[model samples]
Target: MSVLSAKFGHRICGLKDGRLRDIKTSSSNVRNMEELEAERAAQKIEYAAQVKMEQRIHNKLKIVKQQFNSILQSWHHSMHQLRGKVPGFV
Candidate 1:
């Protein structure tokens, strides 16, 4: 059996067989297309925020690495200069 409903779409009969879960009862509680679109918008916003945060972290890491390398090079240069000043230092 089948029922054509303009408000709730097609309703299948006999399939329910007097079962509670098989019946929709009403369209009020059922999720609509608008709700699904809203959820997708929220997810896209969340994803963009996460990507921005990750990019900031990556940029900070690069700056710290550059500073460390600069310090190491300066220290090495000073050590070589000190060695040249020492007497009989090969």
Candidate 2:
């Protein structure tokens, strides 16, 4: 049968065969709720850490790109200078 049907059968057998008891759930729910809240808090912390890491990586990449572009521009300038378009090294 389906999962729900199987679970229902188990619950029924448990209740009828003295393997389980009829009990109130009010006393046992706080722990589950607390665990769920803790999980959410942990997820938020993990997400913040990930965002910080991504920001740092983006900043590094931007700096690297700027440095590369500056080097390329300098190389172009020197090549043009050697061709005598300008008689000075800029």
Candidate 3:
């Protein structure tokens, strides 16, 4: 026997309930698939958020690296200029 539930769906059946253990077991086995589906959706949302956060962190690190490289290049250029001015300094 099948039941109708607007929440679970239009029709519900316990095909895996072993014929519902004479109806009781069957109805029990007719669990709501909505729970499992809802959990999957939540997990997907969490994974997307995690990915977004990681991308943001990666972008920030790239900017910092570029700034550091620029500073290092300027410092090297200054040292090179100073060495040229000092006759004894190689």
Candidate 4:
């Protein structure tokens, strides 16, 4: 006998046996697909938020680096002026 025959025997000849099982399986499959879609949507939202946060942090660091470079240039200019004032300084 086939697998279907073993499971349902003469019941397979009726409309309720195999049909009902197929319906139940299809319904559960739909529910599982919906749940998986919802989870994927949530993950996408989280990933977008994370990318935005990383961009903000990168911009902040760029500003900090610019400020540090400005300060370093100013310090170097002051040192050059002091060297000029000091006698025998090359």
TM-scores of all predicted structures: 0.58, 0.62, 0.62, 0.64
Residue-level lDDT of model 2, residues 1-90, one tens digit each, is 112122211322244434544333343464565689899999999999999999999999999999999999999988987878755645
lDDT of 2 at 54: 100
Worst 10 residues of 2 by lDDT: 1-10
Better of 2 and 4 by lDDT: 4
Which window of ten consecutive residues has the lowest lDDT sum in model 1?
Answer: 1-10
RMSD vs true structure, all candidates: 6.8, 7.5, 6.4, 10.0
CA lDDT, every model vs. true structure: 0.71, 0.68, 0.71, 0.70
The global Cα lDDT (0 to 1) of model 1 is 0.71
**Candidate 1 segments exceeding 4 Å error:** 1-32, 87-90
- 1-90 in candidate 1: lDDT tens per residue? 343332343244543455322245445434564578799999999999999999999999999999999999999998898889997765
Question: Candidate 3, residues 1-90: lDDT per residue as tens digits?
Answer: 554333332354445554532223333334546667788999999999999999999999999999999999999999899899998876
Residue 57's lDDT within candidate 2 is: 100
Give the residue spans of candidate 2 off by over 4 A: 1-25, 85-90
Q: For every model in order, what is the number of clashing pairs? A: 0, 0, 1, 0
- Model 1: number of backbone collisions: 0
